[model samples]
Target: MTTAVITFSPQGLKVMQRIASHMAVDQYLHQAIAAPPGVTPFERVVALTGEIFSRYEGLVYVAPCGVVVRAIAPLVDSKLRDPAVVCLDVGARHAMSVLSGHEGGANDLAIAVANITGAEPVISTTTEAVKDLIVGIGCRKGKSAADIVTAVTTALAGLELPLERVRLLATADVKAQEAGLLEAAAQLNIPLRVIDSDLIRHSTRPFGHSEFVASHVQLPAVSEPAALLAGRRTSLLLQKTAFNGITVAIARENCPSLA
Candidate 1:
């Protein structure tokens, strides 16, 4: 596994260096004093830092406050492909697991580093790590929106749920209009329903039901709306409309009551 340490302050850089040296893993360690152009310092760090460890399988890191850590948060959330993210205070007195700690060996690394540096390791991804159901899907690079829809459709079908009983769909609105999604819905005899953002906002039923399945499709930045909808029984379909990504949640209706 390769690790990239991004920091702006000299003191923070030194702390990262010590951790890297102590770990003694065959990892790439790179330091940047300044953020790149046209990007926030955080985004720059994530982009540059990501490149350094691209050749390796895993990533470990000590991100200090400032642009570097903030910008990388979303990218790490969306991309990074299961990379381990750990944050360190300026003096290396405390370490926190902010991302990918459980599955990516970040917890073990935190313990090791804490023992050596005498820093307290704070882990936050405990629930996700234990349950491990938050799966990420990546569309093939440079693939067309149509292709992405096909892939997602095929993947959803493999889950093997009855197409008619599904309801409660969620996704970016733009994906609701994609040719691939429409086609898949027609072929599968499902409804590609649109979700209103406000519903997902003020509702306690985020997960809807165990029978409910969610799909996220990428979309173009300007043409998407974050939306969610619930119904008693309706099949749901998701297709990627653009590059920004969308999430669809499908639920099965309860049996009709005859009073």
Candidate 2:
């Protein structure tokens, strides 16, 4: 579905034109309608434009005035798929992403448009820290939940490790409680450990309980050990070239409580 940009003034048209020039022509559906001053509230213009594209999926509305902003308020709450609503002043001084940013890719798109139009991009969320390959592993609402579960299960098994041993499952904590890792875990009879930033920092092993603590826990070095255990369920075997008789094994164990 093409992203929709609705505007009322010639100045707004210029802003949309600049945005379109930078992006694919088919990506945007630009509607330049003339609204006379004091004839209709800005809100009514947004509502009317929204109603025209109500049946289409992935429609993003951008308006340039406060009155039009107020008019678009109701449409903001409507049950539409992939709706990205943004507003900018007629002068193209600032652009605000008011709704459906992260999942809808609005923030990124807004920044792109802002750069082209010389408007400020208002992004609030901080970027994800400790970069790793992020796999989207959950089912979205209004879709087949089982299909998602099956796909995740297949990916997990293909990794060649006991499913229970895979730690650091990333997802919304609350969503994890409902429709996240539980189904995949049950299907494979493996425990799925949910993790966030705090856990990722302290925990050495990404899988089941581990007792073996590395003498030093540092990056680049720690990544090697993690790579070794990526697909294996057992402890890693390390050999010392100097001492032929001595060998080192790293494994996860239960942590002892101070109490």
Candidate 3:
């Protein structure tokens, strides 16, 4: 989905530019969407917003809510088909998902934007409050996507959790190149978040470790700390389970504060 980040002022444009820089580097971590125009091409807010509503899948409006709402009022349509819209204050203090919070991907976009701008994300989606489950996975270098799906789905079933409850799939940064893991997440329609291995190894809570894993990844474990780090939880819903060549761990939390 293409993201159109529209700024109303020079300061807002500057902040959006900074966000664009991070987006470039993190493209692989998250699906890369088209970069927003460097500068706001249209001088008029209403015209720009109408054009965005017509053209983009996502909209990042770096301006006051009132301004954004007024500009896009005429374009408002059914939530089922409307584009996801996020509003960030010109000061970059808060990122709020203004429309299509879940199905349209606005909530995740708000969090992503907040991650870049150090802004507090105001996520009000009901599912976000209730469905905060993170699945952590680790596997051999050449595991198949089907193997990953089987391992993860079996774990979730044992825990009595539905797939829709999953908010993200996490793994160590070193495994960012792991094709099986990426394909599994893509198949399941879950966002894959890669956490730095240092942070995982230095986690406050002890994780299940192994000498073999240490020899390979320099860390005793991957899924546990990766899940804890991504979920911001102190405990796991399901301990590490290994089958064939894949390992899966489950973590649960209720919309923990973003890092």
Candidate 4:
């Protein structure tokens, strides 16, 4: 599905560009706001939204939730037919599924944006919110996508978990640009969260330390820390496991009731 990111303010435009830089998405900026090349500028949000409401499969608004709600209020229809709408703060702090959370693929889009921007995905769907599996991966440079997939699938299979249960695949931002990692995520149809190195370094949660990782990536550990930090109320369901040049860890996010 085609996606577009739109914003009104300069700060929001920066966030929009950050997302668009990683994902294959179009950009729409308010006419009054200045932007770099490749971003289409529009006169009014309401008019622009109407024009592209049906044109794109996904719409990410890098503005306040109220602004997005107001712009798309009139265009909302059935979830089956409407495009997925995600609301993101201008700071790129949270990606919320504002419309058609489940049926329209907004939930997935929210997670994808969050994964790319190191933002939190605000998914309110009961089933999704309660979801437990997070797979964190760390691989040597230039590993094949097939190798990464095989290692992840093997790790999940050891615990008899299905692929659908794996909501997020997280890795340090240092590995975020790896083509193999990105392709594995695309092949699995899951979001690959790129956690900042500083966040991992400063995380309160305890994880195993790897001297090699500390030397190269400047982090204590990659897979374990990434798994534990990706979601809310998380705990390590499975510790880091190695296969060939890849290391994988699994973390489970507890539901509110469970917590």
Cα RMSDs, all models: 18.5, 15.8, 6.4, 2.4
- Give each model's whole-structure lDDT: 0.43, 0.41, 0.77, 0.90
Candidate 4 clashing pairs, residues 3+ apart or interchain: none
Q: Per-residue lDDT of 81-137 in model 2, one digit per residue for the tens?
A: 436556666577666765566565555455545545656556443331111222223
lDDT tens readout by residue for model 3, 1-259: 6787776566776677877776642111101223343343565778767755867778888878998899889998978888988999979878899998888888878867775675656777876656678888989999988899999999999988999988878888778779888889889877676676767677777778878789998987988887877754436888889978888888887445532
The lDDT ranking, best first, is: 4, 3, 1, 2
RMSD score of candidate 1 (Å)? 18.5
- In candidate 4, what are the lDDT values of residues 1-259, reduced to their tens digit? 7999999989988898889888899999988887689999999999999999999999999998998999999999898989999999988889999888888899889988987787888888776655678999999999999999999999999999888878789999899889999999999987787788889999989789999889988889999999999888788978999999999999988866756
lDDT of 1 by residue, 121-154 (tens): 5654534222111111222224354554454454
Instruction: Give stretches of model 3 more than 4 Å off.
Output: 7-47, 62-74, 87-96, 107-123, 196-198, 210-220, 232-234, 254-259
On the 0 to 100 scale, the lDDT of residue 134 in model 2 is 21
> Measured by TM-score, how close is model 4 to the native structure?
0.88
Residue-level error in angstroms, candidate 2, position 55: 4.6
Q: Quote each prediction's TM-score.
A: 0.38, 0.38, 0.69, 0.88
Q: CA lDDT of 184 in candidate 3?
A: 91
Return the lDDT, model 4, position 217: 80
